[model samples]
Target: MINRTVIVGRLVADPELRYTPNGIASCKFRVAVNRPFKNEGEQQADFISCVAWRKQAENLANFMKKGNLIGLEGRIQTGSYEGQDGKKIYTTDVVADSIQFLEPRNSTGSTQNTPNYQSSTNTGGMYQGSSQGQYGGNTQPNYSRVDEDPFANSKGPIEVSEDDLPFD
Candidate 1:
């Protein structure tokens, strides 16, 4: 059975990062994904609860913020917990394995309802989508092979007047 899910959306707020007793990193955040179709001629959105574990969780909290567009890939997870009312509440969320930043263009900016999340590290920053889409930490990207150089022969060597180079 396929339980994997992928989604792209803006974060509703900043991610909250925490560490367990074993120092294992984790974070939880919600992304506001716009629907492909508008709702009643207005923008429709779906908020997804996502959790990142280990390094990915740390990285997300380190570099992601509210209002940023992000991509997520994970599995649907369901768990039950006892509420304060002594009732068992069942919850579902995405167990995020990979997350990519897609919008608002920063690590920390414009997050709504940001109360349940904060990073021990930098609270403000931006996240860029990686080629491998690895979560947390830095990954060396594979550069595409380019056959030609962009600046090889644009212009011949010409003696520039003192004013042309703008060194003055």
Candidate 2:
């Protein structure tokens, strides 16, 4: 049985962060994902309920806000609970395994302030601004402008050590 889901959308509202009695953090939020096709010339969106736990939950609650674009990978979870009206309430949610902020805070369609997040390597969903910082390096990565060639300074063949290769 394979169960996985990926979604890119905007948050409908601010995430609600809570803690379990044992002091574990959890966050609940909704993502509004637009349908690929328009209905009657109007865009359609689905509001999906989602939950995040541990450091992921805390980071999301602290860094993100309503209307911010985000991408997440997770799996669907379903359960039922007894309601106050003596009825069974079925609940469905996407338990987020990782989340990426698609845009910078206070800006639309901008990449500034956006953290470089690698979901595969970062299960905790915490983005540390850059890979160098995350891997315990003090040096910052240099980003060249579009008109500038990154290899312009090279005049000879680049040296590559065997250890630098991904495979032997």
Candidate 3:
């Protein structure tokens, strides 16, 4: 069975970070995903609850805020618990395995109070790259130049003969 979800959306509110009694970090937040089609000339969006743990959680709470675009990859999780009124309370959320900040710090329209966190790449719930001790030190990935294209030096297109066709 496959259980995975990928979502790219804006945050509905600031992430709330908390720690367990054992000192493990966790964060919860909601994401607003707009529907592809318009509903009565107005776009609709779904508010999804998500949870992140450990370093990912800390990073999210410290760096992300309402209206910031983010990308996440994770699995859907559901559970139920007994309420104080003796009723069963059901909960569903995405347990994010990885998260990426889709926008630059200054582009999110955030105010001056937002933490000036340097974004870093995360994979498989693990922080990757130089986090400057905020998220622990990790080796950064070497990225190639974005302006250079490998196929830019291609010559003129060659003419193809009908004899080279596989199906005719």
Candidate 4:
């Protein structure tokens, strides 16, 4: 009865963020996950659709772009609708509960046109970053400098007898 799924992959394109009529934030993106095994000497990859909501959606759209590596936990969702051509279209997507950026802020690969996003562990445990023109407002976090070392006053290495060693 469990429907949980976890995956780590690179984004195939930038996440698209949109607001519902009620002003709720939502994002949609695709991830390219490569298969561990090769098929006839060629690597295979599957493109998965994913959706996120609330602050997670906003953060994802603002900070992530194509070629960025990310890990996500979610549940598989499926739905169907009638298309304009009178055909039933079935869709499958991952409804993400949480996402973790696997790479450092500066390591987004190959997609140079992507915006720079720097995340910090502030904002009540939410990943906050400066929103590019796509999103509005920028609240930079205050970082404190640690100029003094607590061990600066310590003497040289302490001497220990063989009795302190648990093994020979």
Give the candidates in order of lDDT, highest first.
3, 2, 4, 1
Instruction: Report the Cα lDDT for candidate 4.
Output: 0.74
lDDT of 4 by residue, 1-168 (tens): 898899989999999999978676888999999999999999999999988776778888887788898877777888899999999999999877667776665677644444333333212112233443233333434344456977789898779899999999
Model 1 regions more than 4 Å off: 103-168
Better candidate by TM-score, 1 or 4:
4
lDDT of each: 0.67, 0.74, 0.75, 0.74
Candidate topping lDDT = 3
Position 48, candidate 3: lDDT = 98
Worst 10 residues of 2 by lDDT: 118-127
Question: TM-score order of candidates, best first?
Answer: 3, 2, 4, 1
lDDT of 2 at 168: 72
lDDT of predicted model 2: 0.74
- Report backbone clashes per prediction: 8, 0, 0, 0
lDDT of 3 by residue, 127-164 (tens): 33455433333433633335576767879776789999
Regions of model 2 farther than 4 Å from truth: 108-168
Better of 3 and 4 by lDDT: 3
Better of 2 and 3 by lDDT: 3
lDDT, residue 122, candidate 3? 41
Q: How close to the true structure is residue 118 of candidate 2, measured as C-alpha lDDT? A: 26
